[model samples]
Target: MDSFVYSVNATVPIFLVMILGGVIKKLNIIDDNFVNKANKYVFIVALPAMLFKDIAQSNVKKDFDISFVLFCMIVTTICFVAIWLLSELFMKDDTMKGSFIQGSFRSSAAILGLAFVQNMYSNTGMAPLMIVAAVPLYNIYSVIVLTFKAKKRNEDGSLIEVSNAENIKKACINIIKNPIIIAIFFGLWFSVLNIKFPVIIDKTITSVASTATPIALIVIGAGFEGRKAIKKIKPTIIGSVIKLILQAGIFLPIAIWMGFRNQELVSILIMLASPSTVSCYIMAKSMNNDEVLASSIIVLTTLFSSVTLTVWIFVLRMGGFI
Candidate 1:
C-alpha cells in the first residue's frame, strides 16, 4: 500500500499536468505556435537551467561509489548500443530510430528516480550517485543517436540523409553547443569546486529551472495526437517493454548477486524501472527525430510506471533487498 501510494504521488501529478495541457488545447486556450515556442524554450533554456541546478546541487564527490558508477556506466552503454543496433536492423523507419533507442534505455533518473528513493528511504541515499553515473551518458548518447539518425524531408517529398561526414562534424559542434550538455558541465564544475551562488542568483536559477519540466510536458500534451499514437503502437509497446520491464529484468538480479542492498538496491531499481525521461522527448523533437513516437513513449511509460513501480517496490521489500 505504501509502495502504491508513493508511486501514485510521484506519477499522478505528472499525468495530471499533461492532461491539463491536453484539456487546454482542446478548449483552444493555446495554439500550435505556443506549443512550438514552448518546446524550444524548454529545450534551449529551461531544461538546461534545471539540469544545471540538479547537478550543481548534488554532492557527487562525497557520496561517490566507483564500483557502482562503473557498473551503471557499463550497463547503460550496453543498453544504448544494443538498442541502437536492433532498431537499425529491425525498424525501417529511420525517423524512429533515435526516439526508439532513447525511449528504450533512458530512465527518468533525475526526477522520478530521486523522488522514489527519497520517498522510500526518507532521503536521497544513492540516487545522486546514480545520476552522476548515468545522466551524462543519457544526454551525450542522445545527442549522438539523434544526430546520426536525423533526416530532413526533401523538396520531392522524400527523406534525405543529414549525417554525412560534414553533418557528422556539425553534429559534434551541436553536441558541444547543446545547452543541456553545457549546463551539465558547468554544474559539475561548480559542484566539484564547491562554489556557492548568491541567494538572489540561486533563486533566479531556481525560477528558470522550475519551468523546464512543466513547460515540456505541457507542449508534449498539447501536440499529442491519439491517432498518431495508434500508428506508433508497435514501437511504443517495444519501447515501453524494454524500459519498464526488460532492462530492469536483466539487471536487477545481477545487482542483488553483486551484494547491493537496501537504499542502494532501491536506487538501482529506480534507475532501471522508472518512466522514460521527459528530456528524451525534448531532445528528440529538437534534433528533428520522431517527436510523435517520443511523446507516445513518454505518455505510455508515465501512465504505466505507477503500477509497475509499485510491484517492484513490493517485491524488493518482500525479499528484504530494500
Candidate 2:
C-alpha cells in the first residue's frame, strides 16, 4: 500500500500538469504557437540544462561502479537495438517506425530514477550511476533512430527518398550537434574534472533546469490531438507495455541472477521500466516523426506506470529483493 501510494504520488502530478496544459489550450490561454515555442525551448535549452545540472553535480568518482555501469549500458544497447530492428522488420509505416522504437525502449531514467530510488532508500543510491550510464545512450539512440527514420517531404507533401549515405551523414551530424548530447558531454567533463560553478551561475542553471520537465509536459498536453491519438492507440498501448513491463520483465531477473539487490536492483528497475520520457514527444515533433504517436505512448505509459510501478515494487519487496 505504501509503495502504491508513493508511486501514485510520484506519477499522478506529472500527468495532472499535462492535463492542465490541455485544459489551458482549450481555454485559449495557450495556442499552437505557444506549444511550438515551448517544445523548442525545452528541447534546446531547458532539457539540456537539466541534464547538465544533474550529471555535473553527481560525484561520479565517489560512486563509480564499472560493472554496474557496464550492465546498464549493455541492457540499454540491447533494448534499443532489438526494438529498432523489430520495428523495422514489422512496422510498415516509416513515419511511425522511429516513434514506436523510441517510445518503446527509452525510459525516463534521468527524471524518475533518482526520485524512485530515493523514496525507497533515503538516498540517491545507485540511481545516479544508472543515469550516468543509461541516460546518454538513451538520447544518442533516440537521435540516431529519429534521424534515420525521419520522413522527408516535398512542398506538395510527397515523400522524398534520400540515400543511405545521406542518412548516415545526417545521423552523425545530429548526434554531434544535439543539445542534450552536448550537455551530457560537458556534464561528464565537469564531473570528472571536479569543476565548480559560481553560486550565481549555479542558481541560474538550476532555475532553467527546473522548467524543463513541466514545460515539456505542458507542451505535450497542448499539442496532443485526441483523435489522432485514438487512431494510434494500438501502437501506443504496445509501446507502453514494452516500456513499463516487457523490458523489465526480461532484464530484471538477469539482474537478480547477477546479484543486484536493494538499491542497485531498484535503480535497474527504473531504467528498465519507468514511463517513456516526455522528451520523446519533443524530439519526435522536432525531428518530424509522428508526434501524435509519441505523445500517446507517453500519456498511456505515464498513466499506467502508477499501477505498473507499484506492482513491480511490491513484488520486489515481497521477494526481499529491495
> Which candidate tops TM-score?
2
Candidate 2 segments whose C-alpha is farther than 4 A from its true place: none
Q: Against the hidden true structure, what lDDT does model 2 obtain? A: 0.92
Best by lDDT: 2
**Which tens-of-lDDT digit does each residue in 216-238 have in candidate 2?**
99998898899989988888988
lDDT of 2 at 79: 99
The number of clashing residue pairs in model 2 is 0
Model 2 poorest ten-residue lDDT run: 85-94
Query: Any runs in candidate 1 off by more than 4 Å, and if so which?
Result: 162-164
Reference-based TM-score of each model = 0.96, 0.98
Candidate 1 displacement at residue 57 in angstroms: 1.6
